[model samples]
Target: MLSPMQLSKKIQGNDSSQRINYLYQISKKVVEKNPVLSAYYGNLAVSVAKKNVLKIHPDIKRQLCKKCRCMLIDKKSAKVKIKNKKKTKYIQVTCNTCKMTKYFPANKGNNHRLWLENPEAIVEIVN
Candidate 1:
């Protein structure tokens, strides 16, 4: 029922998604071995997604440094620290490359209480 042009656009979107996934995988594999190469792949993936107006998967997005766009491997490319303030526990992940910091609130008795620890809640970012 769709026009040829519409079908072609759909195919192109699928191709873009596949390419992005491939790039993410490559970056993940090489991140520990060669950070520069991994970062190159990550940048390529981001550029391709941006060009196609596609969103990178949240799992992949979270593993990258927002400041340097570098692939982050724990204790290797990133340093993670937990801090408590006013009875609130939070985690700070600092990228070793750019020294940029990202903080996530922890165990706040909220709905988001450690998504990894909660098996019942679906791991989807809500808006």
Candidate 2:
């Protein structure tokens, strides 16, 4: 299987510009008259790009999961714990199903804490 970085480059590579444009066009075409459809395509573009993001930037990769043609924020996004130990930051992911745990470096900046880690919040960040 391709590593996350490889997959990310493939998705965000210049070759994919056309596909991304197409998704935007489709999403725009249905936005007003068919909002649901617009959202469907928007979600698709985001989904496809998300995997690419994970590949290119594995630090935050686990937050998004593939769902159909769109990338959906895995419920597990909320399950991640960020910590600063010694001179490095770490991410801890808990498996809700099997109770297994995995760890990674918290490489990305902390912009997402407000969204994923915030309580009393019911929101999703697709794009």
For all predicted structures, in order, the TM-scores are 0.65, 0.31
Query: Which window of 10 residues has the lowest lDDT sum in candidate 2?
Result: 117-126
The local distance difference test score of model 2 is: 0.44
Per-residue lDDT tens digits for candidate 1, residues 4-60, read 466345435657777676566666667777777778878877888999898877657
Pairs of colliding residues, candidate 2: 4-55, 47-71
Backbone clashes counted, model 2 = 2
Residues 1-127, model 2: lDDT tens digits = 3454663464466344344444544444444455455556656566666655622222223332223222122242125677778888886655433344556666566554443333222122213
Candidate 1 regions off by >4 Å? 1-14, 86-88, 106-127
The lDDT for every candidate, in the order shown, is 0.66, 0.44
What stretches of model 2 exceed 4 Å from their correct place?
1-61, 64-78, 112-127
